[model samples]
Target: MKVKSVIVPSGMEHLTKFTRKIPSDVNVVPVTNDDSFSNIPLKILHPSKKGRGKNEDSMVLYGQFGLKSFIFMGDLDRRGERQVLQDYPSLKVNIVKLGHHGSRTSSDPNFIKQLEPELAIISAGRHNRYGHPNQETLNTLKMENIS
Candidate 1:
């Protein structure tokens, strides 16, 4: 299938080079916090204010699929996670894409407890240099009974 558009977080200058690399024929749509699509269940959820680092500026998305809900955390660290919880205290999900590749810096135990996700997804290379999928994070998921 032919790719059509690439949606990304807006107002981040660092992404300019990345966006420029996209094929000219494809549409580049930049979205910000709380932005929603018409007739779609997806919505962007990132901190609006500038963060201390690019990782903190990562986008978090919430979407609903039928009776299930999911939250996608894009490289957000503990600080960003705290802010998100403060902004949306009632937020809950059935699935979660753990932030920062399941690094210790991102998945705070409290954050996991609050979300109570049924499943957690950690994307990382098994032999990555940074040693991702930290044991602490795995312990958190296991303690929470998340698969």
Candidate 2:
């Protein structure tokens, strides 16, 4: 499968390892907030407010192939998600991967409502230390009628 990932420094090493394990023929696109790696093509987004001087924490992966668009928010919190929504008001996506393991820090109600995705996937380990898949986040999804 063709894959596009939002590159954040916190997870780059892990991402690189996983991407290397993928089949050679598959296309892997790494979109980042900064141009840290010279070898890989990068799409740099707007800089953060703190003047981090680079794309820090605001990024959402957009995967488009044929007629489908899938959006993945990697560890993105409410602020990051809001930035994305504000930047792209008319954004339409088929699938949404909940950020921060569906923690309350991510998946704001308004953000979820705006996406209106057909499928919402939450990737979190069961009984995680953070108590992920937070009840609040799940309730917000249910309120929006998203399964």
Candidate 3:
């Protein structure tokens, strides 16, 4: 199936944000809390801030199909996670892609508890400088028993 639309953060251009092929007629829209994709049954959520910068505004993506649900967090920090928790109190998914590669600045314990996912994945680089997948985050995951 063709990609009908791509929802990105407000004011973000296609060229800088992506490397894939996007057809001219496909709708490229901004990410908003209220909007969601129909074809893939995915809902995109972003921080309150509109401007793009070093600030963490990771767009949390929730993809649900049939009985399985997945939450993919893109470099989201603690604040952004808090915003998500506040916005969606019932925001629990089966699988979660950890934020900021499990950096100390992300993956708050409360947030983990809320999610209560069966499996958690961290997209961390091998021996990266940032010390991704921090020990604290791992400990939190272990404490929560999120495999």
Q: RMSDs, each prediction?
A: 2.3, 7.1, 3.3
TM-score of predicted structure 2 = 0.66
State each model's CA lDDT, in order. 0.85, 0.69, 0.79
Point out the worst 10-residue segment of candidate 1 by lDDT.
Answer: 8-17
2 against 3, candidate with superior lDDT: 3
Sort the candidates on lDDT, descending order.
1, 3, 2
Listed in order, each prediction's TM-score against the native is 0.85, 0.66, 0.80
Residue pairs in clash, model 3: none
Which ten contiguous residues of candidate 3 have the minimum total lDDT? Answer: 11-20
Per-residue lDDT of 50 in model 1: 42
Give the runs in model 2 whose Cα sits over 4 Å from its true position.
1-58
What is the C-alpha lDDT profile of model 2 across 1-147, one tens digit per residue?
A: 455443443333345556577666654443344444554433333223333212235455666657767787877778788888777789777888888889899899999999988789999999999998999999998898888
Better of 2 and 3 by TM-score: 3
Ranking according to TM-score, highest score first? 1, 3, 2
Candidate 3 residue-wise lDDT at 123 = 92
- Candidate 3 on 36-89: residue-level lDDT in tens? 555656777674546463337557788877898999888888988999999889
Give the per-residue lDDT digits (tens) of candidate 1, residues 1-147: 898877666655346567668888888766677677886667778856544337887889899888889999999999989988998899889999999999999999999999989999999998999999999999999999999
